[model samples]
Target: MGETGKQVVLTYEGVKKLEEELEYLKTVKRKEITQKIKTALSFGDLSENSEYDEAKNDQAFVEGRIALLENMLKSAKVIDEDDITTDKVNVGCTVKVKDVEFDDDIEYTIVGSAEADPGKLKISNESPVGRGLMGKKVGDEVEISVPDGIIKYVILEIKK
Candidate 1:
């Protein structure tokens, strides 16, 4: 058994990325890239063939990525969007925050690292800000000390 019986909370975006990558690997990359390998191999002497070397390298990388994605998908526990609520902070919940100092408001979805895109305001569970907001409720305050400084954030809203 795994260390934690609880399932991992993953955002829809995170799941999509994995699914897309897996599909691409099994369909497009596998067939097309493997063909590249076959074509390169047909060139005969592979010892000094740059084309063969590059193709082999690319093939290795593609296959390795496919294997990795397969493993992750096998162990995946996708979090349902319906499981999120505005009552309390949790993974998949879009958290609206207010900077207590600068009086600025920002919204972010607390998701797994795989789906976290800072520019998109998606935070990772491992992030300090995300950690501080976990299990918090609206109107609650959370303080996190970042590299810049310690900033206090107030929970404005939590949504699915």
Candidate 2:
């Protein structure tokens, strides 16, 4: 939806989150910054007014964020639920893998780059682990190359 070159893949939940953020920025944050600017303007002497300058900077940041959100939304592609399959690794699927070296099972929710939150076990398809898991089904073993060394994992489960 964005310009010809830009494409942003997102899940339904990701789209909702972005829409909520955009709404908050346009309504609440915009108003708060506008009020700050008005209060600063009342101080008079714009050349020496640090408050005014700060408010202007805040306004610029907010506007830039708004524009960025708009562009992202324009290019957003929501992955459909129907497209999710447990037979293989893909974005929007949850996968459980056993570390060959550690002998521990780790779960990861594969998502687009826009929604990658490693702390929450959500990984981007571009990540080393995610890339190694792509198109792999349960019982498949993968060897992923990381910066330190190669990590080996066996796919335990895949869920929608």
Candidate 3:
């Protein structure tokens, strides 16, 4: 059966990244993992070969990740950045904000759940910043409470 879930709306960039990952997994990564398994099998002793065991574990993880990506792709609904018309926050918007308390400027790209990367400042729609930023227009100030503190930000720009 197909993916049984609501379709996730991913930004154009997010979808592109997913596509790239899928390509790499199906091509380069798959081959590399298969070779690893094969080489480990040559060591013999399926029950005692540490290399074989490690390779099997790695294979399992890789296969699981592949399945997950395939499912997401199956259920993905790619959102066209150009079609989202608004000065407000959106999944594809790169928001630049000035901290209310610390007086620091931070930039983030709002994306779907699969694309969250806090270190890179790409937040998921389910995140505090992403949720707070959504539907807020430029110049609109919003408060988001993080594990650090409740930080405030002004919506700078929303782009396609």
Candidate 4:
């Protein structure tokens, strides 16, 4: 998301995850795609070879992702756990919040844009909810405006 050449902030775990993914893409995935291409070449008739086309497309995608990951790693800045405080919501903090409208309790781990996994309840610091929650402490109430509507959340707790 930081395509403007801004430094990408990452947690320690985020860095490790990116490193592992880059390694897998470079080694296992690259080899697999190469074998697929070679096998497709053996089948002859390059003009009508769907396998060849698919393999080539996959190879391009893999290479592109590898380059993106490499660039991100080059500009990566890891957030130290020791520097994280519980006084307020910030990047790398786990926060428990209650939705004022729905009356539902939700937990989110705020992280850098690169490590944000919404399905896993890990939100990017740049996200609307995360941005609204930042610098907020327990008992603080916040209203986040989104495209759909406004969401109100109360800060219940903050953890490391």
For TM-score, the strongest prediction is 4
Model 3 stretches astray by more than 4 angstroms = 1-6
Tell me which residue pairs clash in candidate 2: none
TM-scores of all predicted structures: 0.84, 0.90, 0.86, 0.94
Model 1 C-alpha lDDT versus the unseen true structure = 0.80
Q: Can you give the lDDT of residue 49 in candidate 4? A: 100
Which residue window of length 10 is worst by lDDT in model 4? 1-10
Question: Candidate 2 on 1-160: residue-level lDDT in tens?
Answer: 2344568778999899889999999999999999999999999999999999999999999998889888888888789999999999999999999999999999999988778899999998888888889899999999999998999999999998
lDDT of 2: 0.91
| Model 3 TM-score (2 dp) | 0.86
Each model's C-alpha lDDT?
A: 0.80, 0.91, 0.80, 0.96
Which candidate gets the maximum lDDT versus the true structure? 4
Candidate 3 lDDT over 102-122, as tens digits, reads 888888888788878899998
| TM-score ranking from best candidate downward | 4, 2, 3, 1
State how far residue 112 of model 3 sits from its true place (Å). Answer: 1.1
What lDDT score goes with residue 107 in model 4? 99
**Candidate 4 pairs with clashing backbones:** none
